[model samples]
Target: MGLRNYLSDVASGVKSLLTGMKVTGRLFLRHHKEKITQQYPDNKDTMVYPERFRGEVVMPHDDNNEHACTGCTACELACPNGTIKIITKFDVTPEGKRKKAIDTFIYHLQLCTMCNLCIEACPTDAIKMAQTFEHSVFDRSQLIKKLNQEGSKIREGVE
Candidate 1:
């Protein structure tokens, strides 16, 4: 009985091993036609970013270097992680009326979770999610970026 049981165990192990090898052989043959792995960085130029992919928030500036942010602090208020900071300065118009304008728009990329809350909260369509996710830096301060450029002013007719 013991010899019969040992022979049955050996037969079962051989069957299992043969089944696994068959699957592997099939995969090895099929690999020529179907690629299962992607070579990243090498395929970066051919990579296509899908729509609705939220990577990072960026403020778009036109040729005149004007942005749509009115410094309403709506983005700052919507950020649950406190990743956005809006510094405002009162601009004196020719009529001497003080108008609020954005001085600096600080975005802490380290703390941002890319939740798209700030983009959705922007009323002026100033901020939008950019399709750029590869943002790695050695220094933490490098992660903190100012979205607005130097000498950039609010776009005309954007309240």
Candidate 2:
């Protein structure tokens, strides 16, 4: 009886192995139609990302080089990783009234986890996540980017 049981166990193992091999053989034969390998760099131009894909943060500046950031620091506060820094400047109106404005908006790409919390916290809709994912750089200083365009000022209605 023991001998019969051992023989049955061996037969069962062999049957399972053969079944797995049969599936693998079928896949090997159908590899041409169902390509398992991607061409990588060659397919870069054709690669498409979803609408909701989060890559990096970018501030959209208008043709006038103006943006909606009011130096409110809402983005700085909401960032979980302290990736955003806002340098403020005082804008003096014609009436000699001083108002707070954004001097520079610094974004540390190396520290950012792309959580989108900063974009959500912004009341002025200033910042948004860009679809550009290729952010690799040789130097760490290159990763720290200014989201605002050069010589860009806050929009007129942003106050």
Candidate 3:
């Protein structure tokens, strides 16, 4: 509007530009001295992920591919979004005992937010987050992973 006001506005714009440029100039000068990125794949073995990194879910297994899940359903109950649907079935043991084993441990990754509540609520430490982050797939159905192998027997004395 006025000449004085117009000149002040231009001065403010120039000041802002110089301020931004100062930061960029500093970063450019220090770029060569600092290592900002890692050489991935090569350094993957030595690489350390942050403690709070949200990766994919994986059921922990022992040497025999047996897990400690007792079909407690605590994780399923803790998941607010119903991402984890665990179907359980009772089996009559040779000693005439009705044991609860997980029939199906279906995890819908598309519906999960990696909240970690399910992991915490698990009484037997059945589930945990795996560091494998590459879960991209063309089909939506591929995102749902069955944790338990087909025809796998639940470990005895897991309860």
Best by TM-score: 2
**In order, what lDDT does every prediction score?**
0.94, 0.93, 0.86
Candidate 1: lDDT of 93?
Answer: 76
Tens digit of per-residue lDDT, candidate 3, span 5-100 = 999999999999999999999999999898889888789789888766778777877767788777788999999899999899998899999988
Ranking by TM-score: 2, 1, 3
Error of 3 at 4 (Å): 15
For candidate 3, the clash count comes to: 0
C-alpha lDDT of candidate 3 relative to the true structure: 0.86
Model 2 alpha-carbon drift over 4 Å, by segment: 1-3, 94-96
Best by lDDT: 1
Give the per-residue Cα lDDT of candidate 2 at 122. 98
RMSD of model 1, in Å?
A: 1.9
Model 3 regions lying over 4 Å from their true place: 1-23, 35-46
Note each model's CA RMSD in angstroms: 1.9, 1.7, 3.8
Sort the predicted structures by lDDT, highest score first: 1, 2, 3
Residue pairs in steric clash, candidate 2?
Answer: none
Candidate 3, position 78, lDDT = 94
After TM-score superposition, what is the CA distance of residue 91 in candidate 1 from its true location, in Å?
Answer: 1.2
